[model samples]
Target: MDTQKIPSPTLTLPKSLTGIQGLDEITGGGIPKGRPTLVCGSAGCGKTLFAMEFLVHGAMLYDEPGVFFAFEETEKDLAINVVSLGYDLDKLVAEKKIVLDHIHIERKEIEETGEYDLEGLFIRLNYAIDSIGAKRVVLDTIETLFSGLPNPLILRSELRRLFRWLKEKGVTAIVTGERGEGTLTRQGLEEYVSDCVIVLDHRVTEQSSTRRLRIVKYRGSTHGTNEYPFIIEENGFSVLPITSIGLDHTVLSERISSGIPRLDTMLDNKGYYRGSIVLVSGTAGVGKSSLAACFSDAACARGEQVLYFALEESPQQIMRNMRSIGIDLDQWEKRGLLMFHAKRPTFYGLESYLTAMHKAVNDFKPRVVVIDPLSSFIIGTNQFEAKSMIMRMVDFLKINPITVFMTHLTTGVNDFTGIDISSLIDTWLLLRDIEIGGERNRGMYILKSRGMAHSNQIREFRLTEHGVELLDVYVGPEGVLTGSSRITKEAQEKAGQLLRSQEIENKQLALERKRKAINAQIDFLKAEFDAEEVETLNDIELNKLRENLLLQDRIDMARNRKGDIITNKNSINKARGNIAKS
Candidate 1:
């Protein structure tokens, strides 16, 4: 079989970067280049701002001149609105890099009786494009242009023509539209554009509003289909793509201190892995925030930047409170090594908070971030949302390789689940109150720490004037002891030990006395034996003298008898023998 080897079309599509943080990443490098993209949303959903940002980003960042045809606002209104974002529109205008045209349509003047043609509109748009040699265009809205014309057939035709003309003009464009009932746009502009369609939504749940963006459709391109949370502030628009960050982030082996040396000792003699998520969870007044402050202090002391997001307390209040623990957070703040963003959790939605954190991190480029009491995010929502937000947050920070130290205040004294985000944490430090001897004491232990051998012993720590001092909890026959009980037990043991030492000393002295008495008895026995030996020698000498005297007397008697018996020697010997025989 003969197979024809046909060349495959380029898998990648030409794209224009939006220059908006996280927006370009989700849209796969912005919307399709040189094509019309529809941005539709309800009122106050930032549809117009989205489109304007596209144009402004195009002009300023890409060096591509742009034309913005506004149907709702004038040039002055648009410029004033965007000026807060630090965009000098008038300067761009004077430079002939941008062209702003406002199309005014009074609905009261037109009737629904005739065909609507956009030839005149086309001429003005073409002139604007030609004037600036624009490569990007933004139509503030599609509804305003067709508001006077009620015929759907004519609206569809003109919408298609508008999109076609923009495509032929070879300028990447964004057309803003009001959301319709169950439709993406009021006039079904998504059908005409066909290239790209983005939907912005401002939804309020539980009295909290969050602005979100989702790519509805993109022809011939893959994009992030999930709804991405976005924010608009003085700095400008930002989109937070949750799934855009994956688990492929680079990991680090470096470790940073938690500021408490004992706590670090509990964690494998190292504090925490760099670019890892650490969660400190505890009950109320269990010193969760204090531990977080210690981490921040340690990081700042190391000359690393820390972004502390305080949800409950103000920066001044936190600094003041931390001062009692001998931690001067204000010094780090003044030195510009630490930055605090204190805001109430209810001030905005979770997504807004996420976006704010994202912006703060991006702007500050912090090496470490501290979110004290992450449980506060669950004020109005459930744990699911908070966990999702935290997951996204962890993913973002992990990718940046920033070490995150978070504090979570548990609801119950024994409850360890703080928004149920334990699985996302790499190191979890659990603190609780240990009640003993009618007194409560603080104890901390590592619940889990990945990639290291951590201590399982619960260390009772006190928040004294010198900071967190971890104490050794006594474990004995009375179970674990802390507070006064531990102190009392230690004192009793010390007294017993002292008494035992005294008793041992007395026994050693008694043994020494016995040893000395035995030595004296041995000395006395040796002296008695020496005296008996001298007496025995004297008795033997006396017996020898007596025997010698008796022998002399017998010799003298024998000599007298022998003198009468014999005269010659031979005869005396013979006579002595005969007398002996007789």
Candidate 2:
């Protein structure tokens, strides 16, 4: 009869501003409620963006008003900077959902007194918050205070006071600071804002710039410690948190055709999986774009919207080229099933491109996306950054369950130059121009198709007025043809052999039909001769009849035998040739 005492349960928490996509899972809902978060970073590390996004999202998504105080940029510049990200700061200000206050603290414009404190900042922030009833506050680049006030001791004390004041105000705040060499910030602000610390980094690896965000420490809460990759897109920043989802898990059982029946056959009796990433890698002038367009046209024909991002070629150029290949992309575009985004890889930073891509995905909500020649993006970035960008892109695509087609340019027949993106793809199709004998020919082969059995043989491909046609599998002494030389020789041999066989078969079938008709005429002549009156036949008539019947029988038998022999010989030769080649 002893009763056990029940322990009190921990209180469940509310949602917080994750500052990233898919980051709330790691933080158990968000940062602690109503406390300041410190975001410290070097130049161009996106600390300002992180803090701005938090406030913007809070105002827009959670129905909480926010206040943004900038010490460096003017309110106009901040509004313009976030405009591309789909944040209408002007409208938000009008609606009283958010307030932006820019404090111009120019050292040359004003002289600081000895008893100067952040009283003005406190007053401005207090007025903005009370005016808008803001639940979130952000001070972008609070380090600008140091630029105006040269004394570090006073700045540190002021920072501590600012944190305490923000807590007293009970508004969750983000204070951004510049990173120092050894310390977190040049003014040691990290010590003052000890509740939460986040570090943003922008580094160049292998000539590519990558942005990463890390949680240095979160007081009274658990947070992810690893540096998560993030991209600044039109809709704001998208942080990529690497989860442990297994790659081998079964995808959707549905299949989609590659637009070419022959190519589909090469894949399998079925086709590519619904949500698979297809990589088409080959040398220059190998028609990767045409292949991608063909696939796109097929999808469009099936009523699926496609988003095609051409990094190297303009949309008009792609449309003209595809038209030359007999693919009418213009019609699809007019029908609103195909959208093209053509831009230079170096037009903006990698994060900007990522952001643009993100915006396109959200706006279009396409079923399939194609990025022509992913290698072009590798020019400004190092190998590691390129790899990371590609990985994040793939992960984002996977989450959306959208089919992606990427093309890469290789250097040689078997040599992959620059960054190798094959590892991130689910299916790899290698197209090459093989040289055989004295002519050049095109060949295509599927190097690998994960989770499916595909043809291992290299098949010849040809571009015609109708479209791309896949020729028979290349069977030669040097195995399959690869370059232009090999392809030419294989094509010539195959064409000759096919023509010769068809000629012989045609001759045999024609002879067989002629022989059967002759046999019928001979039988009829014999019957007439046998049925004629036996007593009164003239010698010339009988002799003529017998001679005609004999001639017809002889012709029929010889022709039929010739047809059979020719047919058998052709079949045997073809079998022997195949065996010999094998």
Candidate 3:
């Protein structure tokens, strides 16, 4: 029998999920397994919070215990500070799922105790890991030991050795450091932790503050390279991964009403698509808020939720204003279908504004979201940031498959602004104050609605007690007519037209009566002349007949007298013979 030697099975490292939603996504699965990661950031940049979330989410979500060794903050201070973030460290510690230890190295203690390597720190970390069976470890602000201990030569050597030991022990760990002027970490710890490095920055530009994070390098894995904006709020650290998604989201075929029937008709009698982004840009006093409220009214009417992000008005103010126009947002709020998140754009940078909106949208999960007058952000110090944030929000809402109606206030007299993102909008409603001769009227038109044949005619809209009312298109003395003036002007013109028509009718009737009278007189004269001529001709013919009869009688009498004389003379001689012959 021949004995064969089997090759030793190969073991590759497995990644340790950070449990940070955005961090895991950007890191492509989290940090490399059983390897140390470097997290360097400037002061007050939320490094400790990021690390703590990593541990807490791991322990809670994945059931992987973690150890948090604080080199800068004490265990008590860490526990107190994170309480506001809703993380109960003591509870986790009591359950034997987490371990919190504070390391304090005083400069005076270093002189009294003489030089020593960080060998004790290795032993302590291993003990804590074994006690809780933690799969993760965090050494927060580990660079502080170098400053406090003041034995740079020996401490640097041991710090390098400690990283190697942690790796060989097969426990995933995170080391945090303050960012140096030139190097990534203050003590260049990034050079030692060769697995992954993340950079956090808290920058203030033009009096607006923002927190950003970027992955400088990932030795064996791919990661998102762009700087991501994050927020540190009650829910702990949340990184907004500005990831670009392809047009792969599902497009709903359902239609939604904009609450104005006229506007709906303008949109092919179907309103807007179920997740389309509708932009309403207009001048001041142009009923932008009224339109947005109309949409909210429509949503609430359908028993769907609506989240209204009001940047210019408080909830009470918006409710009062909309109530005056017949939209009862208050009633919807009582019904628990409407939510309002009001904030001043000036109070924070554009990023903070986006964070608030993101959180509100997530919590409410409404079918509709309204950002009333996104122009408020544009008026602040950061114009570019405002536009970028708005675009990102539009993308997010579209992905949520919720209908969006964002109002933008134009500057000067224009009904549009340079900040108008036309391409990103599925429907753009351009509203304006049709000002002429001291009167201002509201008019709206669809600049563009993709995939829909919308009305091009500018329909005049009026803010009434019955909500938004869209009037028919009428080009009167004003460009578009509305209110009593339109009615009065139309009535006066109709009356003038009626008067002119009646005058023409009267003149035609009078001419017809006169023509009939003249024709009757001509007929009577012609009848009289014909009767007289017939009587005269009849009398002359009768007289001529009587004369001809008398002439015939005279001729007969002369012939008879001549014949009788001859017959009498002849009769004497031939009386005997004529008597026999007769």
Candidate 4:
């Protein structure tokens, strides 16, 4: 049978790269080229910052000079504001790569008239664009430009003309606006006249704030519609588009160590597959962090970079604690192979956390990532939201093919992560406290490991001064034993075996003595028989001598012993016959 493969569409619309992290990917390349894109949001929602970044990126990175026509802030104020975000607008202007123009409209000096038009503003913008040969333009807060005009008909006409003039100038532009109550923009016309519309949102839930971005409309292009989380920091605007990731990331057959050799033995004797998501879950104080540290130490020893996110403990605290278990994380930190980012879960919202992590991972470019006690993310959010955030993180890390070792704190003996992210996990290890004989001991078991033959037996987990150790738990008729119970059971079996051996030795010794006594009795009987045979032979000899002497005397008396000797046999027979007849 022949297989058929469908080819993907090759046609795509012309777009100018935004140069902002993760934003271009969501927009399917970027905003429409040689056209205006409307970015609207409420106060302090990073609308102006987004526009400034677009212009600055075009000037500095893409070699496309830009013009910033600001109506809200002056040129000096714009330069000062963006300087903190690492954008040297003054330098770009000095280099003739950017032109900043401040257009101030005094509403008190304006009167509504039919002769009103944006022709004057266009001439000034046209001069600025031509002076620098700019390919990008940013009109921050376009509402102020027409705020003086109270006539709605003229405002709409001027908005369309302004967008059309930007396209005619062949420049990609961003128009910032204040979010309206019922519409996307305050004037409710910018969204319709622009080629693409992006909405920025700043939301606060439970006293925690997060910034999100959404592409409301993209004309003549395909774009991501999901509400993506974004963050503004010293480095600039970063958006984490969760929907931009897919399950098509490649899987690796290569395996990496879990840091604990015995634990690796339980995991098909090779360890976790590289790029796989490994979840280590246990109740409180079950060495979850310790296990994570071991993995970090092992990765750093192999000269691979590791990013550790500690939500509960501080970096110093984690390092000090790990030192108690013979895992020196400080050494790896000094070697620059390990980094610890410690923060509280409440320090940021779920989306903010995801965005920050996304940025850190991208910047560090580490091969291994460790998130200690992932359950802390569940403290302020629901299970669904937490799982969603974690799923996005997992997808992002997998795309980088980084080995992930995440620790989770469970409330009970069960391995449920509370976020229900087991399906996304490639390997799940459960650590539990086994209580027997009035003592508690740690036990580890591989709950599930996809695509590997893992051991199902529970191993007694020990945290020695050296490292983590996994020993075989005693499984017998009495039940699974561990700790002192296992040792005691082993001692009992040894004693029983020794007793059986001693019994066999004693029986063999008694049988040997009994055989020796029987031999001694047979020797005594043979000696007695020998003495009796000697005496019987002596008596027969003496009787023979007496008979011979008596015959000699009879021969001397009778005329010669020779005649008696010749006839001795016949005479003896005749005498015996005569005696019988008498």
- Write candidate 2's Cα lDDT for 448-523 as tens digits: 8998889987878877767788877556676765445555776788899999999999999999999999999999
Whose lDDT is higher: candidate 1's or candidate 3's? 1
For residues 1-582, write the lDDT of model 1, one tens digit per residue: 546765344547889998877888997788899999888999999987888887888888899999999998999999999988889889999999899988887777866656557788899999999988999999988678666556767767877888898999899999899999989877777778888889999987777777788998999888988887777865688787755556788889998888999888988998899999998888889998899889999999999999999999999999999999999999999999999999877786777687788889999999999998788888665566677678888988999999999988887776567566777889998898889879999888889999999999989979988898899999899898998999999999999999999999999999999999999999999999999999999998787667655655555666877764344556546544644543
lDDT of 3 by residue, 235-255 (tens): 777666755432567798899
Best by lDDT: 4
Better of 3 and 4 by lDDT: 4
lDDT of 3 at 325: 91
Angstrom error at residue 484, model 3 = 11
- For every model shown, what is its TM-score relative to the native structure? 0.74, 0.67, 0.72, 0.74
- The full ranking of all candidates by lDDT, starting with the best, is 4, 1, 3, 2
- What is the number of backbone collisions in each predicted candidate, taken in the order shown? 0, 19, 0, 0
Local distance difference test, candidate 4? 0.86
Which residue runs of candidate 4 sit more than 4 Å off their true CA positions?
1-11, 109-114, 150-152, 245-256, 272-277, 297-308, 314-341, 348-369, 382-403, 423-426, 435-439, 448-453, 476-480, 484-582
Candidate 1 Cα errors over 4 Å, as ranges: 1-9, 107-116, 130-133, 149-152, 245-256, 273-277, 296-309, 314-342, 348-369, 382-385, 388-404, 413-415, 423-426, 449-453, 476-479, 488-582
lDDT of each: 0.85, 0.80, 0.83, 0.86
TM-score (C-alpha, index-matched) for candidate 2: 0.67
